[model samples]
Target: MQDPNTLCRRAVEYLEEYRDSQRHLRADGVGRSVGDVWKPPPNSIFKLNFDATVFVEAKRTRFGAIIRNDKGAVMAAMSTGGPPMSSSEEAELLAGRKAVEFATDVGFSELVIEGDNRNVMKALSSSLDDRSLLGNVVDDVRHLVYGMHWINFSCIRRGGNRVAHALVQHARNISEDVFWLEDSPPPALNALYQDSLLL
Candidate 1:
């Protein structure tokens, strides 16, 4: 017969392996579910998806935002290039700031702001005081949020924010910031078309 200690050890090992497999299965499921697609906000609300791209060589960061209504029709779009940033997270924070300023300028009171950077989104969405490197940016974004009649900040999978990503890429080729009413840059048109289909 096997010794009791040996049997207990074997049981523990088997249980650990089982638990690990279960964890992996759950992770895999989540991974498979992240097929990013743009989603509209509720009626009377505008959804704004934003993204930022940092150009190390140019020493600048580009931001892009797209605002759409519940019907998924594009309301407006913006692409801006700004000063250099140290990290992508910081760039993302700037994008959030830009989105808020753009919406506010456009007289939009109700909006949902989304981005692909989870860390930046979490900082902006939560009330927790930012004590890290992005503290100042977080503070500014909070100030913007408070000015809005109603605003929701959220993080989305990169796949879901492709159009914003594409817009920033387009911004890199332009000299100045630009906004669109019902049109988009030619390079970003394909991504805009794809997002429309998802809606």
Candidate 2:
């Protein structure tokens, strides 16, 4: 359908049914549910840009995100991670959910998700339901995003997600204890990239 709302709504419903077949974490253990946040007040506006770094060597996933206003200056930037699952799709969804959690944790009440994973973006816009071949990871992501705002998933290319992309590149090569900035590599990432040192 040309109507994005109707499409997203159907996908949400399919996701809910998928979640129903899965186990729920005890209420306290599930980090913050997306329900705690406020929906856009009818037509309110906000945007969240997100991306994930998947490392083949360590099988890790690191997500980076930024919240921006209409003018596009960033209001928030964050990074989070967990072990990677079987498919790139799972990594993408995990990144999306954690980014949303970070936004709500800091009181963002209205937002849409932006990411480079076309797979998850397409799934969020369609009613088709099947394991992402990623299993519970998909359900966990769906559960985390059950409510809050006119949350639409927009597909972007990696180059368009520069800030978050940079973070993921760093996460893949840098040690956990280090941080870097502004085109300057962390000493650790620098060394690893050179193949002169073991990370």
Candidate 3:
């Protein structure tokens, strides 16, 4: 198994590769759209944007989640590390679960859980049972959703998930899970501010 330091280094490298790919896609105008900007949730509701990075070679995964009020102000944020994942889809499913867990722990009931993984979001919002390899994780998230007063699953482009992405990337340097209440971490502050600009 790779040491934590080595895993962190790999995480940073993977993040850079992902960013490069996104840049190339944008330059090709393949995924650019007006809706790429993050939007605030409705009044009395909170938006939780979550993202995850899988270091398959390192047998590890990292996920970050941010909760914001209708004004787009950060209410809480978290960066957490987890065990190995076989696929990005599994990683995303786990991320969504972690995000929901974080939000509920922070006392949020009305929520819009957003992520960049279209397939995961679709499965999450669907009423049908999931039987894939990641079905258990999906079921876990759905069960959490049932406990909420109101909840919605939304899929947005990666560009719109910058703040959460930044948080996941920032997880590289930490040895343990980190949580911020009523504040945004320094690495995500700029992205958080940029998101508020669109509100």
Candidate 4:
């Protein structure tokens, strides 16, 4: 009793699933073929750090991030944004998405995202609550998740994310323009950030 159109759509979805399964199987077979040789693990695991800052009541909202690797070196793509939110939560999600884009564009195999926002991390680590706005963000997050071999989110105390935190605070003073730091922010910002006791 289903509509003919619905049936055709379902059929196409089944075919797509079958194709994906075959592709995965072929990839696994190739890995098995190379099992006898020792291989080093992938090096594309990069660390993504995020933070957000609000200046004035709603005047300035900024989000920032840094992507680093095991060597503690930063990636070329760093960004700070005057994101679309009137609140910190909005900046947090915007920063998170920027991190996701950096990972995808740079072809990282694994991503470890750290943020100073505990609420944002808790929301992402848990199942999406259908009634909450976070559900919408969680839905978009899955798209980035699918591209990674491994993706993990951790909530760190603000003190642990000074580099990213400083970026946001620094951006809060600037105009609508978004800035990418070349040599990192000045020592005063770092000193002020450490003294802020953001932890």
List TM-scores for all candidates, in order.
0.79, 0.58, 0.82, 0.62
Off by over 4 Å in 2: 1-44, 127-130, 173-199
Which residue pairs show collisions in model 4?
none
Give model 2's clash tally: 0
User: TM-score for model 4?
Assistant: 0.62
Residue ranges of candidate 1 with Cα displaced over 4 Å: 1-35
Candidate order by lDDT, decreasing, is 3, 1, 4, 2
Note the Cα lDDT for every prediction shown: 0.84, 0.58, 0.87, 0.62
Q: If both were scored by lDDT, which would come out higher, candidate 1 or candidate 2? A: 1
lDDT per residue for candidate 3 within 24-89, as digits (tens), equals: 644533444756888889999999999999876666889999998988888999998977777888
Q: Could you give candidate 4's per-residue lDDT for residues 56-167 as a string of tens digits?
A: 5756667667666655545533535554566677678767766676667666768787776787787666665635766676666667777678977777766557677766
Q: What is the lDDT of residue 170 in candidate 3?
A: 84
Backbone collisions counted per model: 1, 0, 0, 0
Question: What is candidate 1's lDDT per residue for 1-199, written digit by digit as tens?
Answer: 9999999999999999998876664452343344476787999999899999999998889999988899877788988998888789889988989988888888888999999998888889988888997798889888877878888887899888888898899899889998987666566687766666555
> How well is each residue in 99-163 modelled by candidate 2, as lDDT tens digits?
77777766676677777788876765454564656545556555555666556667766544555
Scanning candidate 3 in windows of ten residues, the lowest lDDT window is 23-32
